[model samples]
Structure formats: C-alpha cells, structure tokens
Target: MHDAPLMLCAGEALTDMIYQGDERWVSRVGGSVWNVARALAVLGERTAFAGAISRDRFGDALWAASEAVGLDLRLLQRVERSPLLAIVEQGEPPRYFFIGDDSADLHFDPDVLPEYWSRDLRWAHFGGISLAREPLASNLVALAEKLKEQGVAISYDPNYRNLMDERYAPTLRSMAELADVIKVSDDDLRGLFPGVPLDEALRQLRAAAPSAFCLLTRGGQGASLFHGDQRADARAPAVAVVDTVGAGDASVAGLLHSLARHPGRSLQSHLHAALAAGSAACLQSGATPPPPAAMQQLFELLEGDAS
Candidate 1:
C-alpha cells in the first residue's frame, strides 16, 4: 500500500475559461479545493488531491497539472463525462458562471478512497461550490466525519459565492461544526448573513462551530483568526495586483503548511504565514502558485516585518 499523504484535499477540479480580451479566452485548472491542494504541494507539503475528474481533454490537463505540481494523484478518479467549466470574467471582484451539470467533479465516490489513507492523513480540507451541490456535498461531510473519528484534523473554507447562497447557511454550519479550522471571507459573512453586522455574523458562525478556529479574511485589508478566547489578525502584504483568483486558497495552503509543522503555535503566527501566501498568489495570474524562490522571498519579508 502507498503511504498516506499528510493532507487530503477533497472537492471539485474543473476547467476555468478566463476572459482575456474582446474575444480571447484561456482555460486553466480551477476549483477551490483543487487550488488549495495544489498550493500545499507547491509549498512543499505532502499532499493528495481527491476529486472526480473526467477522462476528457480538460481532465487530462487538470491531472497533468496536478502531477506537475507533485500532488499525489492516487485519490483522483476519472470518469466519462464532460468537464465542469467556469467562465470567469476578471472584474473588480471576478464574476463566474459555471457550465456543465452532472459533470465528473460532482461524482466523487467517498468509498473509492483507499482504506489506509486515513492512517497517513494529518489533515483534510473541503468546501466551495462542491458543498452547495448534491451528492458530493453529503459525501464530503461523511468523509469529514470519518476522518474526524480517525483523529485527523479537518479544515474548511466556506469560500461562499452568491451562486451557492441558498445552501450556504446549513452547509456552512454543517462543515464548520466538524472542522478543526474554518476560513471564511468577509464576503462570505455578508452572503451568509445579509442583515447582520460583521461581528454578529462571525459570532453566529463561531457559535455553530465552537470547537473550530474561524479565520475571517478581509481581502486586501488582511485576515483575522477567532478561536476560544484567542484572536489574532494580520495585514495583507503589498504586492502587485495580478488577480485575486486563488488568494484565499493560497492562504489556506499557507496556514496548513504552518499547522503541519507548528500545529500548536499561536494564531498570530499562522495568520502571518497565511497572509504572506495569499498576497504572494496575487503576484501571479490564473491561480498558479508563486515559484519557491518567490515564496521564500515573501516569507523572508514577513519575518522582517515581524521583527
């Protein structure tokens, strides 16, 4: 049997068709959970990606990209179906319209995961549009429960989008309750609780998942972490704004990287690394991770800031 990956990222892996100019479009590997898994591997974590991929050209590209990033692909299953496609317009906040229903991404089978995978995994991460969908959402929740029972840490990013507003609250509460760490954006807060104040919205989320550390990310303003009687915040580093495509995913990866090493460190330490990783991702385009040298430079800069 293959050794277990330190981290398992479960959810959708799809192709994003990004608008460039008047008529030009570019397709890239895109999905919140996939992005987090890829970023962790790029940042040198022993990570595995768990998602349903099609056997089509787009899926081939996605799989090849995962291999290039050194992500363990054993958990990636292929099927005969059209790939999920997202038409992304790089607006101020970036707009997305997903194409293709009943695609392979939503067909992930929890039972297919290797029996030994639970033993080697230190952490598992899930969320995004995957949780808003049908069978996959329930599958992921069950997987999280199983992993939790096995003593594996679970992280969730409610990277909530308006497209998924309907299922937002219940799913958020569900995953947040099982998560060891939960990351939410200011936007997610608004979407989850429109009339409530930011603090109140956050309080509601905390109440639902009292045992988890909830990290609230205020894009550009930085991020904050809320735990039991513990709070920490950090400012986003200054970087050229390329695109905020995968900034949150990168932040999750950074936090996971730090947690894998210093799981018991203060929230402030984790936030610092997370902010740096998130900011560094904006220096590139299309959810691609920064080069190791760039990440190193950013980390050094963060260290200097702390000093």
Candidate 2:
C-alpha cells in the first residue's frame, strides 16, 4: 500500500550470452520488459520493475543494473534459482536459444502487487516471454485485466521470440484488445503473419486492438504510430548500429516517457521522441538508453525536421 507507482513493468529479466566462438562469450542483462523499465528510469520516469529476480550472480547483476538506473525495486521478488539465459547469434534479425526451465522469472507472483497500486499507476507495460509462459503469463494477463478495470493505461510490446508460436495468436489478440498502446517490430509481424504484408499485418493488429495506439518499428526504415484516423511516421537517421539488442525496448520507453510527461499532447508529437530514443539505443551496445540531455537533443532534432 505504499504510494502507488506511476509506471510498473511486469515480465522477465534475463542474461543474454553472446557466443563469439572459440569458447568466448559476452553476457549482458536484458529482457524486453526489463530493458523498457531500465530505459524509462534513465529517461527520468518514476518506474517500478515487478518481476522475479534470482539470487544467482546473473540476478545480482540484473538487480544492480536496475538500481543503477534508479528503478524502484521493492516489487521485485528474490528467489534461489538460476536466472534465465539466452544464447544469441548476431545477425540481421538475430537468433536466440533460450536456456530456461523453471527459471526464477517464471515464478513471479502477481498477488504480490498491492491492490492499491492500481489507483496511482498511470501506465503498466507487459510483454516478451512473460505472455508466452505458463503460470507467470497467466499472472500477467490477470494483472493487465485488473489494471484495465482500474482505468490504468496498458502498453504492450509483442517482442516475439519463436518459442511462443503455440499460443502466440490468441495471446496477441488478448493483449491487443487490452493494451492502450501496442508496439511491435517488423520482425514480430513477419513471424505473426508469416506471408502477410506489413500493411495487412498492421490492419490485423488495428482490428484486434481497435482502441489502442498501434506502432510498427521498422529498423532503418523508421517507425509509424497509428491511432484511429491519425497517423505519424518518423524515419530513423542512418547510424552505425553497435547491436540492435534493445532498440525496440528503448522505443517503448520513449513512448511511455512521452505519454507520462505530455499527457495532453498528440501521439504524433510523442512518436517523434520515441523514434529518437530507439535510434539512440541502436548507436550504443547492449540495452542502454539515451541520457536525458541526449533525449532532449533528439526531440530538438525532430522539431528541426518538422520546421
């Protein structure tokens, strides 16, 4: 019953082990929702991360990272288990081999969120593997439903990994219907709709989430935000990308930051900032976000373009 969090992120947080061959590996703390939470905190949002964090070394690193960015960690559950790990192969779309069975994040308990939290939560973000798993996914779905009832805005990112194919369609429809904002990448739509064209895929999404602001992130092609008859598109500036690990998460963070700070502004104005944040994240390695100064710089750049 503490002063309710303004923004709460619910989902998995794991380590990505980038195998560089010859027994070389680089590990970084990342998860779709985890990245958004960290990025939002970096962008000066009052955010809370509500997910199970293991007591293992990787978990320690993850917790420290969140704390470093000033994320409220009170809602994080600590457990005695190995954190989830992803063996990744860097490429155009990237490939991931997950090594998580009965992992700590999967054991997160939604009941731990106090009922009063819904009153003050302006926005709740959910996505990644959490919507594809068992008991945890169910917990997140229940939480989203309850938050919707409390009139809290819900933002969702369908960071589709191939592992969720079995239940992806139904889950996507459910989340699409519940979310106030839905962010998905070109890669996500490619997987969800297979041979369907991007425009048609977007149409499908709009039909599914009729009332939500639907965004499509298209890497170098930039991004588009659609809400009813209004539409805003921002083209990404050419930048030497270190790795696109958390670009979409950064985009979500930017969108949330805009919504929280400019509650009365148009989506078009907000999306300009979102595209900037996503592009900035691509310039750096790992799931890092642009600093507050850099974010303002980006917004200025977009304004310059508009003028």
TM-score of 1: 0.95
Name the weakest run of 10 consecutive residues (lDDT summed) in model 1: 290-299
Candidate 2, residues 14-106, lDDT tens digits: the string is: 998987879889998999999999999898888899999789899999999999999988888888877889888764557778888889988
Report every candidate's CA lDDT: 0.85, 0.85
Q: What local lDDT does model 1 show for residue 239?
A: 80
For each candidate, C-alpha RMSD in Å? 1.6, 1.5
Error of 1 at 249 (Å): 0.4
Q: Largest TM-score belongs to which candidate?
A: 2
Q: How does candidate 2 fare on TM-score?
A: 0.95
